[model samples]
Target: MEPIYKISTKKIRLLLAAVVIPCLIISITRLYYCDKVEYVRPLALEGEMQLRNDRFGDGHYAARRAGGKRHAGVDILADLDTPVIAIRGGRARALIDEDGFGNYIIITHWDETKSLYGHLSRVLLPPLGFVRQGDVIGEVGKTGNANYKSMKAHMHFEIRRKGKTIDPTFIMEAENIKK
Candidate 1:
């Protein structure tokens, strides 16, 4: 009797190498892309976020302030009314504190990590709304403490997990990085 399902040893080897190996590699690569800890940048489409390393209240995270205080967010200097986008999709709340942040929007991302865009000139969303990734949440401006004469018009961007501030750079990166 002839074998009902005929297969060759060479064909099996080729299938494993040509198809299975590539699939496995692709799955691993996708894991990095889908990682919740590291996600998309806030201002990817508008332009790059300028993070300066300086002592004089710059955009860098954990920047030192007077009286042993540390900055909780990165201050991204930009033209007044420059568009700011949501890094990931989630529910949003637009608020005005009238002090430090002034006009700000908080988006609780799908991963439950909240992103705050503060010192905004204008907020487009309602008090409670939903936004998609890359949606225009507001425009950068000098509000609250940012309205001081010495401070430039910019977006005070921050990321928080479980009420604690985290560096946005861990996930978000400048799109126009030279390197």
Candidate 2:
């Protein structure tokens, strides 16, 4: 008696080539273009971020605040109406205008991290908003708890993961290069 069965090496090789070749090409492309990826500053700044007591924790993360509260993010001081750009590609998750943050937008980034751009003089994104890295979403303004004639025009920027605020300097370009 003889067994009726067939196995072929050619078909297996073809199948593997079809699937694996594309994946290899994709990986190589990403590795080659990785240097092109950039994170944008929220606004233009003239100098290094000085660790100062702007009283309400100004630009320092975890700095002491009034009433013994701690600051959660950095404040980038700038001229009023200066454009604010997205740090990374993301969707506009929430657009809120209120007293605490004045006008703010919460963006849900591709990496499952969220960034909050607060104290905006104006929000430029649409309601059904999706934004790319470095797109203008708002402008620097003294709003929220920052609204005071004595206060400098600035924006409160925060990067959050798992609903908790993280230091944005871990990934952001600290200096706003003059170009």
Candidate 3:
């Protein structure tokens, strides 16, 4: 007779669980913390502009406003009248002239993401207009909070998902801006 060996079903399940549990934890951790690589630069003005601030997070810049309010976007330092282009294809949702944002344009992209172009010298599109990626939307200006004579001219750019502000840098790396 040949010798025979058998392992219990419970033992096999326990062995598999031990291996699978750690893998599940690792995958979840990486998905939550890893940098996303699917985004494109907002514009081709890398050389002409500089990053003034970044999104709110560890080792990132804090965006704050008057009265100790938290800021919800990134600021790109650029010259006045510098053309502002659409980061991605989207519909022009709002073109408003207000005291806070001055002249601003809100675009709702196909992915349900929204981009806000604030402190604009001029808005090129009317409300509800559709724009293609890289199309000119407006010019940089020192409107709204940036209107003070002492402030430098720049564009207040922001990216949002479902009405919540997210770091624009994540969508378009500041260092990789096109020349």
- The best candidate by TM-score is 2
**What's the CA RMSD for each of the models?**
9.0, 7.6, 11.9
Of candidates 2 and 1, the better by TM-score: 2
Model 2, residue 52: distance off in Å is: 6.5
Clash pairs, candidate 1, are none
Q: List the residue pairs that clash in candidate 3.
A: 63-71
Q: How large an RMSD does model 2 have?
A: 7.6
What is the C-alpha local distance difference test score of candidate 2? Answer: 0.70
> Candidate 2 residues 1-179, lDDT tens each?
76586557898897788677532222321211111245666665554543325644557777777788877888777788988887766677545566677888888765567889888988998556777667788888777778887778788888889988887775445444222
What TM-score does prediction 3 earn? 0.65
List residue ranges in candidate 1 displaced over 4 A.
1-38, 44-47, 52-56, 126-128, 174-179
RMSD of 1: 9.0
lDDT of 1 by residue, 93-163 (tens): 88898878999999876556889999999998744486766667889888887777666677888999999
